[model samples]
Target: MRRRPQKPRPTGASQYRINHQIRIPQIRVIGPEGDQLGIMSPDEARDIAVEAGLDLVEVAPTAKPPVCRIMDYGKFRYEQSKKVSSARSARVEIKTLRMRPKTDTHDMETITRKARSFLEKGDKVRFVMRLRGREQAHISLWITKLNAMVETLNDIATVIQTPRIEGRMITATIEPNNSSSQSSSSSSSSAPSTTTSSSSS
Candidate 1:
């Protein structure tokens, strides 16, 4: 009995068609230095890339004739990975702080400081006040406290979501104050440090 031939396994590099893998007869080619080499046959492009000691890679397959670039494929892939990593690191995160209606002044200050730090770092802050037992009967009082807490950070933050009671909890979201941020940044850059110069007699 004859055995069946196995299919080629998919690979990470399969997303990009390189060199001889590009079956299209013609494509728009970009040189290693990013200069357009005009439309040319895949074989011709492959030859130029070989002369340059690089790979002809298909970057935009959706174009009419497709777009191919001649470059060090390994370096190109590494740069793409770096861009992805940078985007992930630059993403803003939302931080949540929990409290209660009876939280003392010290704890409130701590929470406010933490929220302020988060806002400074360009992250959103979510305030959650959980009501327990008979505390649920007085949501209005809790909302008052929540608003007061928000007011303390008004210089650096703005209320994005007003306090709303959800079941046994009151939630509010706050983000960095754009106006204050701009003013602060401008002032810091414009302000000069004061220093006393000693007179030599």
Candidate 2:
């Protein structure tokens, strides 16, 4: 009699061991809802995962006997990717928007729009109001103008550094309001049904 060929195991995302890829003799299993299911063989655990229509993922491989969880592997990987992308976008980098004291209304609007874009992406923004020659005499006025310029982003950011004159420059820094953004990101991800019912006109 001829022996049947063995199926190949999954071969991507080495950061995790999933399904038949888990070759450990014994492992600790966690249920779909995170309840501990005690020690079991990988084959037994894989059986449960298959019945539940989920993947057995080795989450804590360093732990004694190792720990595995039954979950939707595709969803888990997608959320992890989203978190990484969010982290990179939210990394605090100071972006400077420079304008002279004599910078006009139209130019100021353009600057504020650019600043708003930076703040939305969770970056720190520094507004620089440069003063030279006689423009230095109106430092107070320029500082007020700078403050007003940043007020446009009041809903999305907090002023970290108030506008202050430093030699020939007036500068202020504002950072994104993380609490609001994080709350939105953490909210339930279930998208609403978009199917519409037809009605008689």
Candidate 3:
């Protein structure tokens, strides 16, 4: 079924002060381009913001010297809007790979390759190793395979979940090591797709 589109997020032109109300102490104000305006009282800070045709936004209320920025509330909000949108667009979805207990060595290798591909794309990999019949008695085998698979991916991914036997299946999850690793992984995943597309074209 087609889902209804979510409501658009409020941008710069929309309300900048959502439900937040802040009472700042001494403020070290900064100009629009980040030039310092020294320290001032709250009223003086507001006056400065008013004169500059901007908002007295408390940027570093927790700093030793509270910091405020004189900015167009709407424009500041717009940039934040763009950041959120960019982040959402850049997000990679998690992918799952499942296998039966009797899967062949070659098949396991293929599944490992696919999982590595998924991890390289910055997607979390859910490895579900299913056990059937008396095969459940050999849960140790599945754990061993899971550990080996995770070890193989140590350079690209880290195990997020340890092997846990759940009913008829043992499952684990793996994620990228860090932000740089994530980027590398995504680019690696995209290379194959780009190649396939170029060949098709």
Candidate 4:
């Protein structure tokens, strides 16, 4: 006979609404216009929301008495989308580069070139040095190599993670120098001075 597969457990957010034994608590209703309608029964709240051609969504379900709102679900979802988009637009991207401990000088130079490009593009880089065979016994060599790379890029990049061994690899991360922004701002400030001189004399 075949056995049935076990169902996966619900997440913390899902578990509450599923097994809640309390009464479908009455929700105080409020209109989208920010008007307070005071406390009302669930059925009455639903009726009021339907009359306004909107949804009766529970806003604060954990309050002593839950609160419901009469609002357009479509408009509410649009506002939420705007908030998430704005947050994502403010975040910077990160890039990664991988190398082995036995990597030669030419290859290291190529990798460093790529790392510099990433930093110039306002992206952070993760440098990974993978170890093999007896190389794992000489972890110090990996640290020394990473330090040299950091020194090469010190003017344009800042170390975010010091070299550390994890499993069979040593890893480090670096971000673009914050001074890049300051220098750009200073150059723009000088541009206005030049423009003012041209305008006056």
TM-score of 2: 0.57
Residues 1-201 of candidate 4 have per-residue lDDT tens digits of 222212224435533221122236566778779789888776776666666666566667788687767776556656866987755533555566778777788888888888898778666677877788999888997799888987899989988789998899888977789734544554444331101100000
Full candidate order by TM-score, most accurate first:
2, 1, 3, 4
Order by lDDT, highest first:
1, 2, 3, 4
Global fold similarity of model 4 (TM-score): 0.46
Better of 1 and 4 by lDDT: 1
lDDT of 2 by residue, 70-104 (tens): 88787787898898887665444567788887788
lDDT of each residue in 1-201, candidate 3, tens digit only: 222212234545433321123355566878878999898776787666666666667677667677777777666767877987766636656577777766777877888888778767666777787777898888898789778877888898877688898888888877777644456665554431111100000
What shift in Å separates residue 61 of candidate 2 from its native position after superposition?
Answer: 1.4
Please give, for residues 27-122, the per-residue lDDT of candidate 1 as tens digits: 999999999999999999988888877888889999989999988777777787898776553454567888888988888888888889878976
All candidates' lDDT scores? 0.78, 0.76, 0.67, 0.67
Model 4: residues >4 Å from true position, as ranges? Answer: 1-89, 179-201
What C-alpha lDDT does candidate 2 achieve relative to the native structure? 0.76
Error of 4 at 124 (Å): 0.6
Every model's TM-score: 0.52, 0.57, 0.48, 0.46
Q: Top model by TM-score, which number?
A: 2
Instruction: Using TM-score as the measure, name the better of candidate 3 and candidate 4.
Output: 3
